[model samples]
Target chain A: MNKKIKDEDIKVILNSMDFDIPSEIDAKVNEMIYSENLPAGFFKKLLRTSNPFIKWVPAFASILLLITLGLIQLNRNAPERKPLSEIKIEYELKDKNIKIIWVKKENFLLRRLKK
Target chain B: MTLPLFFAGEREITEKYSNKEVIISFNKFFIPEKKALYNFILKSVSFSEDSNDIYQNTALRAFKYFRKFDTSKRFKPWVFSIALNEIRKYFKNKIQSSDIHSIENSYEQIPDTQNRELAEAVYSAAYSLKNTEREIFFLFYDSGFNISEISEITGKTQGNIKVILSNARKRVKSFLGSKK
Candidate 1:
C-alpha cells in the first residue's frame, strides 16, 4: 500500500529544503546602514570590532585599574615607622564626644609616589 | 566620549547617525526576521535580482512607517506585511504568475545532496501552485509561521488560510505520491 504522506510530514520535509539565501544580504544591509545612514543594529556593529586601538582599550583600562590599585596599596604600606615621640596621637575632648585622630605626615602620599 | 569611542564600532555607528536610538531599535527588532523574510521574498520573486530591491524596499518602508507601528503588537507579522506589499507592488504591472517554466530557468539546478530529488520534487509541486498558495505555503512551511500568523501577515481569516494551506499540502502530497 502506497501511503500518502501527511501534510505535517510534508511540512517537515519543507523545513529541510535549505535554499541558499543566494544573496549577500548582510553586505546589502551594511551598505544601507553606512551609506544611507540607516542605523545598523548595535549587535551587528558590536561584531565589527575592526579598530585596533578599540580592541586594546579593555586590556589597557584593566591594566590602568590594576596599576592604580597597586599604587594605593604601596601608599598604604609606605608609612615609615616612627618612635612614640615622632607619632602624634591627639584626642579632642568636646561636649559629650571624644574623638581620637592619628595625624598623617605632610606630603606622605607625595613621597610614596616619588618612590 | 573618549571611552565610548574606544569600545569598537561605536565610533562608526555614532559618526553615521546622531539620535539613532529609534533606528537602532528598529534594526534590532527587524533583523531577526530578515533571513526567513528574504527567503520568502526570494522564492516569491522566483529568485530574481530584484529580490534584493524588494528586500531593501521592505526594510526602508518598515523604517519609514516605524512610527505608526503599534508598540504592543508583534513586529514579525507587521514587517512581513510590509514585505508582502513590496512584493505585490513589484508584481503590479506584470502578472504574479507561479509559472513553473519561468521559475525552472531561474530556480537553478538544485545542488546534489542527500534528498536533492525529493527537495526538487517538493519545489516542483510548489512551483505549479498559484502565487498566493505558494506564498502561504512557504510562509507556513519554509518560514515556520502558523495559520493565524499567516492570517495576520496576509490579512486573510484563519479559516481561509487553513483551507488554502490544506489544499496546497494535499496537492503537494499528491505530486510527491505520483513521483513514487
Candidate 2:
C-alpha cells in the first residue's frame, strides 16, 4: 500500500532546515555594486572582445565608405558625353533617276563605317 | 565648516543621483531576501562552497542587471531566476570534468542534528532527488513560487512544472516513508 505524505509535513521540514550564508555576503555584494566596476553592458562587452569579425567591422565600414565616396567623386569629376542629334543625308539623283538615298548620319557613319 | 566634495558637483549630481537611487532600491529589495535566496541556493546546489559561489555570482548578476528589472513585477522570482541560471551554468561546467563518484560519495554525509530528525530526513530525501526535481520542489515549497512563476523561472510550461513538482513530492514522500 502506498502511503500518502502530507504537504504540510514536507513544508514544515523544508522551512525548518537551516542554511548558513556568510554574514559578509551582503556587504560584499553591496561593495561590488558600489565599486563602479560592474560588468559592462552586452554591447560594450561584445565590442570589447577580440572576435575577428567584430574587429574587422570598423575597418570594413571605413573601406566601404571610402570606396563609395571615391565612386561618387569620380562620377562627379567625369566628363559628360553629349547626346547625338539626328542628321539627314540627302543623295542626288541625276543620270539614272534612282541614285538618291537618305540615310541617318549616326547609322551611316558608325554602323556603316564599322561594317 | 563646509565639507569638501570628492568629485565635481555636476558629475556627482548626475551620476551619484541615479546610482544612489539604484543602490537604494537594490539594497531595499535584495538585503531582506538575501538569506532566503542563499538558503535556496544552498539547497539547490547541495554544497556549501558551490552554493556560496553561486550565491555571490547571482547577487552580482542581479545587481549588474538590476536596471533591466521591471518594477511592475515581483523581485523575488526575478532574482530566483538569476540564481537558477547560475546553478544551471555551474552544473553545465561541472558535467564534463567533474568526478561522478565523488558526488555519489558526498551525498552520504548530510550533517546530523538531534532535534530535527524530520528536517534531516526531508533534506536527505531532497538531496537524493535529481537536480531538476529538487530545484522544482524547492521553488514551489520553500521559495513560495506559484506554478506560473516557476514556469517563468524554469522556462518550462506550467503543465510541465506541475508534473515535475508532483514527481518530486512523491519521491521525497516515498523516501521519507521508507526511512521510517
Candidate 3:
C-alpha cells in the first residue's frame, strides 16, 4: 500500500503545506517585547540578590522559643505540696480570709469536755 | 565562525542583558531569527491565536532559560523544544477544561473559510491516525524537522520513526483518497 504513493507525491504534499507568518503577528510580538516593564537588571539582579535568611530562620526560632517557654511554664506550675492524709487541715473563717487550723483528734476532745 | 563572533563579543553581553540593552540589541541579535521562529510556530500549531500564544511563551521561556543554554549548540532546536512544550500544554489544558460533548458540538459549527475547510480536512485526516503515528508525522513532516532530529526529540529510534511515518502516510493518503 505504501509502495503505491511514490516519493515525489510525498514531497509535493509537503511542499504544498505553506508556512506564511503574517506581519501583524510579528507586530504583536514586537509590541509585547516593548510593553514588558521588566525589573532593572532582571538577571544580574536576580543572581546578585541573596534570599533572606529570616523567612525560614525566624519562623523556626519562634517555634522553638514557644515550645521551650511552654515546657518551663509546665514544670514551674506543677504541685509540690505534701499529701493531705499526713497532716489534716480544718478551715476557720476569722476575718473574711480563711485560715488553716491543724487539728489532732484526741487533744480536741479533751479540750472540748473541760469547756 | 562569523555568527559566533557576532554572538561572542560585545554583542553577546549586550544581548544577554534584559533591560533596555536587550530591546536595543534585538534589532541585531533577535530580529533576524524572529520571522523564522514565528513561521515555525505558526505552522506547528496551525491556529493564529494559539500560534501567537505559543510563540510568546516560547520566547519568554527561552529568554528565562537562556543562561542554561549551551551557547555552542544551535538555538533553533532549543527554542523549538520550548514551543513544542507550550503547544502540548495548551492541548492538555483544553482537554482538561473542555468536555467531550462541547468539542463535538464546536466541530459542527466550524466556520466556512477556504483555509478553515482545508484545515478541517487535514485535521480529520490526521485525527484518524494512531497517537504515535500522528505525533511523529506532524512533528517531523508538517513541522519540518528531519527524521534524525525527530528521533532525537521524540526519543525514538530512526527505524521506528520510519515505520511510524510510513504507516501515517498510508493512513493520510487513504483518508484523503476516500474523500475524492
Clashing pairs in 3: none
Clashing pairs in 2: none
Best by lDDT: 2
Q: Which residue pairs in candidate 1 have backbone atoms (N, alpha carbon, C) closer than 3 angstroms, thus clashing?
A: none
Taking the tens digit of each residue's C-alpha lDDT, what string does model 2 give over B85-159? 998887777787674334432333344654256666677788788888988999888877789999888899999
Estimate the TM-score for candidate 1. Answer: 0.60
User: How far off is residue B161 in model 2, in Å?
Assistant: 0.9
- The sequence of per-residue lDDT tens digits that candidate 1 reaches over residues A21-44 is 445766776566546565556334
lDDT for position B99 in model 1: 41
- The CA lDDT of each predicted structure is 0.72, 0.73, 0.61
Provide a comma-separated list of chain B TM-scores, one per candidate.
Answer: 0.80, 0.80, 0.65
DockQ scores of the candidates: 0.11, 0.18, 0.06
By lDDT, the candidates rank as 2, 1, 3
Model 3 alpha-carbon drift over 4 Å, by segment? A1-11, A17-19, A22-24, A34-115, B1-36, B43-48, B99-123, B130-132
Candidate 2: stretches off by over 4 Å: A1-4, A39-115, B1-17, B100-115
